[model samples]
Target chain A: MTGRVIVITSGKGGVGKTTTSANIGTALAKNGASVVLIDTDIGLRNLDLLLGLENRIVYTLVDVVEERCKLKQALVKDKKNPNLCLLAAAQTRDKSAVDADQLKTICEQLQEDFDFVLVDCPAGIEEGFKTAISGASEAIVVTTPEMSAVRDADRIIGLLEAKEEIKSYRLLVNRVRPNLVQTNDMMSVDDVVEILSCDLIGIIPEDTGIITSTNRGEPIVNDENSPAGKAYINVAKRINGEEVPFLDINEPKGFDAFLAKVKTFFGIKG
Target chain B: MELNKRFIVDLSQAKTPADIVFEVSNILENPEAANRKIWLKLGDVSLNQSQILSIKSLISSINSTLSLIESECSQTELAAATLGINTKDVEEELQAELSTLEAESPKDTPSEQYIPLVDYKEEEPKESEHEQQENKEILDENKQQQEEIENKQDEQTTQNTEEQPAVSSDINQEENKKDEEIQNQLDSIFDSEVKLENILADDKDITEMQNWPLTKEAEDDFEIPEEIMTDEDYAILQMNTQYHKQTVRSGQVIQSNGNVVIIGDCHPGCEIHAAGDITVWGVLGGIAHAGCKGNTKAKIRALTLNAIQLRIADSYARRPDHIKNIYVEKSNTFTPEEARFVNGSIVILKVNDR
Candidate 1:
């Protein structure tokens, strides 16, 4: 039941890192495992907002490590779940606020009580990124199916693989539009997996719910009704050691489509 | 000198040595990972030193004996998510339902509760005295914003349920409106709790993690026989391990993906491979490969060239020569900066001409 610190990062920015952190943190919490999501973005912190826990923050990672507050004091409780917590980054500070060594020590402290420590890494492979990744036991490299993102993810993967800290790495392809992949217009999940060459963690479909949920500051996993939410829940369960089959978010032209053809008698879409 | 090694574990094909259940970075740092691969067995636990030393505290944490047990038990499931090195791990339907309950209770998470069993207290004090102070300086600025975000969300949920009596209907309405947000809290579980589930538990399964096997640390102690390479101890034994490529020329590839060696500059757009080391005698704009087989210690030496990029042991550093110098700076006109890793990043050092 010891905690694990995992950094969610992609070398390139805007691939939904904060969103992934919020959902994954929420997902793990949903699995009944205590989790703490650390926002390492520092100056550009946003994990608290994404998880909708902006107000509960009493102390932050900065305060805890600086001795301004205790480690437990910095942990912001998740509104939806008591097991989940958020260790917010310092908005006024920069990457220099923390180093890899400090983050590792803090994560070691957090690991005392939490089962999982998911670090929401800032964009770029600079000090901030290095600081964010320093403490994790492993890394979750988040990237989209796009080449640029994938390439940058590859660089990060290379960096992760380079250090003795990360023996191996895994990939999480965010914002995948299965439609484009099926049409051969974009890289398929296999293609992305083939390149990065690590364990494939999970595939999230291009769901508007992810964005709208982010804007609303609620984790998609909280919304049991959305497909993406279900996917995240599945991700959490997987994290917990359950072997769940992959859900094909591919455009379904199944029995429902056939039934719809029969309903064409009543007139649906042309 | 022996060079370093690095690898990306394909959990799908992840394999391990006979003696281990999980091969974390700490384990890699362990004396054993070099000569043998790392794997895990059911009901086995081996995690020590992965967290305290390297930046891979996460790996040490993820590859814990506890997570290994969870994966063996199949309590939680995995789902496909993320952009890199991640696999599709969907949970059993029952676990998915259980996952709902898990979402509600955060602090009491099973993983967090197990820390003491893993000997958490021992690792903290020694490190806290040394590492904690530095991190405090970094997170101070963003802390407030993060705290507010967390508080508001907690209040929001309270307000959501308190103001709206019908929870299910409101959830449904919210779900439909935010239909695109299939991204959920479960994703963090995959990164944190579930990643360990994918750790290769056996040797044969090592490839399941990735296609390549480059140890991040040099796997030494090969027990070199005294008879093999001691030509008077000059020891130039011809083992298949060392690859030697042809000479590099303009548009000249000593070997496609092979190591090309030259003493001068490489012509622009020329591809050269020198599995061992590339010694450029003259200035040439081109590509040079050094220690392609997961060896970061390999050196790339050159006089001068306009080559825009250089690949070394799975990393590429771009030359700022992309923009021609319009004029010399006021400091002093000098040659372009040499490539070096300064402050942990690869950058060109604009050295003054001698």
Candidate 2:
């Protein structure tokens, strides 16, 4: 079956592009869809690490392109899910090792076997980004609530719109601190969606669990208790053409809710 | 003439050179230290000749002559020696003085008073002496073992040379047979770079190769053959060794035609490629390719072998996924390991095992 090729891109660095790609790909796989994640960020690939498939990667995309190994031989199967696979990037090589046309060919070949092919794009609108987006028909622009990240996301969206291959693009606002947004210190998800004038697929609340999950080499999506994990799962569902409602992260929880209630009892505005 | 009273100022506990000076100055502030000969005891803090002279002058300011200095550091001792001060080991001097006191004491005097002082003084030195003896024995054993190994290797080489002519015609046939067996085994192991042309010629279906699971069972696919040094090992030893004395950070690639010896830590993401062996004196946390030119007998060794990937000849092994720590914790203790091509797979062995 032909697969839907989606490129996860962010013009800014450290905007959770790799993390989103890993979690979304994993979440889709957990839903029983055969998925393959391609990491095009040569020399600094972290998608494999995030998926906990770094050691399992015996052959990379470069190896497949250079004919050192077959295309199927380069696909590293996921540890937990047999339906998921990863085409890792060469750590020693730079973006010069791969070009846009070569990646498109690889993606075309992968489309026949998998239900979805997710490309984790590297930061910057350089050769690496061009090569990453070259293979995908859809795009997901990942960004934090910060102005700098939002601006970069807008630029990435513009670039995606300019490309005829990218039929549609969705905005995923990540690391959204709800308390700060309530205090008007940070932008709300609506403000980001309004500023970019784009469709919103998900809003992931800032979770400290992401750091631990990254260090542990496990995707945050596997953590059912985490709010970010739940948000990511919802995003995956939305991607799979399911009607999943957005999470109400704005509501105060646990200790914060207790403090808010105390403030309300005293007739004080919180 | 009356003999001068000796006052010992022990500042051995002072951690830094500045701390030692501060403590010595604080002790000299006391009025009781005046008119006495000062004996300073210092720890492992290295003091230069000028610093020793300054300390001497500070002692002299209290009208006490700096007669002796005892130090644990050899550099400190050398400095004290240069200043014409008697540098002695505290225990040795105490032992000598105790011996003198015993000789001078009358036979009728009670020996009970001397017992405690003798016991305290002897305990530390006795244990240290025992440790020194044990260290010497271990060194001797290591040397003997090394000599024996060298002799055995020499015997093997001589035997190989003598048998070369008789079996020279059969060597090519045997090598072809071994190559066929290795080709069969390559599919089970992840040797992507091995015999690429042959694999392509065979036109094996890509889907036919089973994806090896990342488990203990996959590790068992690697056969750790018995440790036997081949001619390739000797050839690697004969290669020139390049010494590098800097931290190899990420993105930096160190390539050498012969052996490579890095004196610092190889951080994650760096690449080290050597035609012979690759040796890192510190932590090897990056990718190390030993025998990059296809010498199967080459080795990769480090004080801490936490390399992300170890490649020797055509066989490569990545760090197991179970090890979640992408970056190895920087620790003082290290289990030195060496990786080499054994049979058809890469095997890691503790360096001390040899």
Candidate 3:
């Protein structure tokens, strides 16, 4: 079966593009789908580190593309999930070493063996960004609730819209502080959605578990207790065409809480 | 010709067609100047179509009997004498003046106006004057400084023309080098996989996979027309009120050339634009643009209308600052509301029980 190639990209740096990619890929793999996570950041590679496969990386994407090693030899199988694999980026090579067409060829080959190929894109609207998203049929733009991140996400959306290969893209609002959003200190999900005018695939609340998991080279989606983990699992379900309503992150007050409870009890589905 | 003083009314120095007519009419108005030989110097300036027609009529009225010099060279006595035009009186004065000025200045004579219909540099002198004023202050000491600035500009313009070809060729070389590097990079990366993929695909049952839009090339060949008229399209166009039962999620868009009715709420970032009325059974936190096809009579109705913006035809209304505060305070249960185009603006009113 030809797998769907998806790319996770954020135009701005430090907005959890790599983290979202790892988590979503892991979540998809946990559901018994054979998934390949390709780190396309090249010189600034971090997907391997995030997957805890950094020590196991003997050959990387550069080696596979350059024909120094076979595609199967380069794929590092995950210890956590047997179906999940990591194709690490070469820290020695720059973005230009692998062009878009090359990446497309690699992804096309990967799609034949795996059920899904998720690419972790680099930051900025540069050559690396182009190479990362070249072969993807679907895109998940990760953005924070900050105005700068939202604005950059808009630009990334505009770029994605220009691509002929990318059929559709959904926004993943990451690191959202529900408290700040309610207090109006930060932009709410509604504000972000209004500005970007894109479908909200998932809202991942701010969780310190993500950082701890990243430090241990384990994805946050492994833990079933964390809100961020549940959100990601929900995102994966949504990606797999499940109809799941968004969870209420903020504590609804008084009449609002009663209204919300009624809506939930009835499964209003709006 | 009973000559007193030969008044050369320079048409080239005139700012416009009206200026030329005015200058010539002023000289002609004097009874003494009228009787004298009014030498009309066409100079190097060419008149446009409209200006030529206006000036021709103006000149005809100024002097019925006038001697015309076809070229700027004919304005001189030596050139006029050679052409067999009488210049015996002006000939001696022109020779002495030309010799003395010839040493200090190379002939600053105006060039030939071969294409009189195209030349429109009559306002050039005025433009130059404006440029000079901008370069330096008009203070007593800066008059000479202004002239020097103007002279420097003339030198720079000439230098720019001479160096332009060299600069352009350098840029072209740099661009070509960049293109070659990119070509080399692409050749190195894609040279192997592309050939292997082609061979592998050839080995497969071509006819069995032929129907599928599998390859990127095949997908590209599959074109969807900008406007597709399906059974749904036809039905939507014919219906007065098209009903949609699904909630329009963020990033989703629903458009209709006819009236639309959404049975669910419109979330933020969801947009519903229609040519006619739009009615929502639930809340509308999104944007609803009714009368999108310029039908001003269209209206929008919803159970809860706290949308970010509402548009009817050419007019629109954003959620006001006060409305946001009100929404924050009382957002639990919204009263059913209707929005319409009234007095060139979108007006929303609460719907009472009827």
* Model 1 C-alpha lDDT per residue in residues A1-270, reported as the tens digit of each score: 577778888989999888888888888887778888899887666787677654334346777768886676567666568788788876545678778888988888888888998988889988888888888877888889999999999899888887777654678888888778878998998899998787887888888988788766788988888888887787767667688876787763668668767778788664
| lDDT tens digits, residue span B1-354, model 2 | 011445566667644454445445555666656655667777777766545655666666666667778888887798778657889865576567556655776343222111010011111111121222433544454454335434533433233111011111212334334434443333223221211010111123456333562333232223232234688888898999999999998768999999999999998878899999999999998889899998988888899888877888866676766666767788888888778765555667655432
Candidate 2 chain A minimal-lDDT segment of 10 residues? A50-59
For each candidate, the DockQ is 0.01, 0.27, 0.03
TM per candidate comes to 0.42, 0.63, 0.42
Query: lDDT tens string, model 3, A1-270?
Result: 899999999999999988998899999999989999999998777886577655345458998899987788778777678789889887656798899999999999999999999999999999999999999999999999998999899999999999989999999999999878888998999999998999999999999999888877789899999999999999999999999999789977779889989999999854
Q: Over all chains combined, what TM-score does candidate 3 have? A: 0.42
Candidate 3 collision pairs:
A198-B251
**lDDT by residue for model 2 over A1-270, one digit each (tens)?**
999999999899998999999999999999999999999999988887788776556578999889999889888778788899999998878999999999999999999999999999999999999999998999999999889999999888888989999999999999999889998999999999999999999999999999999888889889999999999999999999999889999878789899999999999995
**Docking verdict class for candidate 3:** incorrect
Q: Candidate 1 docking: what grade?
A: incorrect
Which should have the higher TM-score, number 1 or number 2?
2
Ranking by lDDT: 2, 3, 1
Over the true interface residues, superposed, what is the Cα RMSD of model 1? 22.2
* Tens-digit per-residue lDDT, B13-96, candidate 1: 111111122223323443322322112222222112211122122232322111111222221112101111122221332255
